[model samples]
Target: MTDNPTTERKGHCLCGAVKITAKQAPSHVGTCHCNMCRRWGSGPFMELDCGTDVAIEGEENVTIYPSSDWAERAFCKICGTHLLYRLKGSGEHMVCAGIFGDIDGLEFTSQVFIDEKPAYYSFAEDTKNMTGAELFAMVQAQQESD
Candidate 1:
């Protein structure tokens, strides 16, 4: 498993109406336990940080929803397959891991909104966890540094 974004990865929606291409799909997976994520997927959202270099074919077959002030979610309109969770300003996509069949070095490494995670379920993997406030602060700090 690699810690860095190395190779290109491609995947499509359930109905094959839409395709996602990531120029640098990271091997690391980040889990989101925020309320919005859980409500969207019925559980934590496991995603790959596919940086800004992403292409979405069949744009006409997809739907985009502004989930928050800083981010938006997209899905295949044909099959309702979740496609992306992207940052507004950077246009950085954290694509749905489920869409990708099997990636070589994918591994669970981090998690956010841990405080909102319910007690009914837990992941066996050890991950770097951060609360909602911590996550927001971290992002803010990163943006400031940039």
Candidate 2:
């Protein structure tokens, strides 16, 4: 992650019901092309690993869905804007990159579940792509280490 201890980035949901603040700029930005992510956002879900340094303002307006045993997804109840995808085991929150008002230095570095990506749509940027199994293994290893 970049040393961004001084930057405090702010953002809000579509209806302005849920506001969020990140204490530092994201170190890495990535896309998930898994079926669940594609269905949830109608495309690859782009996100930034904000670690645990995020603050939410409209907690009451946020609804969370347990998308998997290992993860849960959160969205703004009013506008249905996807807010975050959190790892249940580690409590790592990957906030939707699209919601951030300032994305000046974030770099799209990876794409997960790449095997499930549709043929019709593709990104021009060369990224580190991992299949679903590879992604799961990486997460599992991380959880074990923690």
Candidate 3:
């Protein structure tokens, strides 16, 4: 926890029905290109690492869905904005980067489930890419060690 003023950021849903405050937001952004993500919004899911230090001003306006066996997703109930993807075990929240408008030095660091990414669309940022199988393997390795 560095004394960076930008670490604490605030954002809201498209219709202003729900507001978000991330107390320790990271500057790195990533994308998930799994099939579920594509079906969720017809494209890759862009996310920011918001961890668990998040505050929801209008919690009643958000709806969460257990998208996978180990992860869940949420969105604004009023405007249908895809809000976040959360990890079940660690309780980590990766919020949608679009909702935060713009941060000063955010970086497109990595792309997961790259093998599932569609051929028609691509990013030219030269990010670190990980295939879906590699992602699961890494998770399994970690879980076994724990």
lDDT scores for all predictions? 0.92, 0.87, 0.88
**Model 3, span 26-93: residue lDDT tens:** 88888999999999988999988898999988999999999889999999999999999999989989
Q: Which candidate is the best by TM-score?
A: 1
Model 3: residue 129 alpha-carbon error in angstroms: 0.4
lDDT tens string, model 2, 70-126?
899999999999999998866778889988888787777899999999998999888
Q: TM-score for all predictions?
A: 0.96, 0.90, 0.91
Cα-based lDDT at residue 53, candidate 1: 97
Candidate 1: the clashing residue pairs are none
Question: How would you encode candidate 1's per-residue C-alpha lDDT over 1-146 as one tens digit per residue?
Answer: 34575678899999999998898888898999999999999999999989899999999999999999989999998999999999999989999988986677788999999999999999998889999999999999998999
Worst 10 residues of 3 by lDDT: 1-10
Candidate 1 differs from the real structure by a C-alpha RMSD in angstroms, to one decimal, of 1.2
Going through the candidates in the order shown, the clash numbers are 0, 0, 0
User: How many angstroms is residue 7 displaced in model 1 relative to the true structure, after the best TM-score fit?
Assistant: 1.0
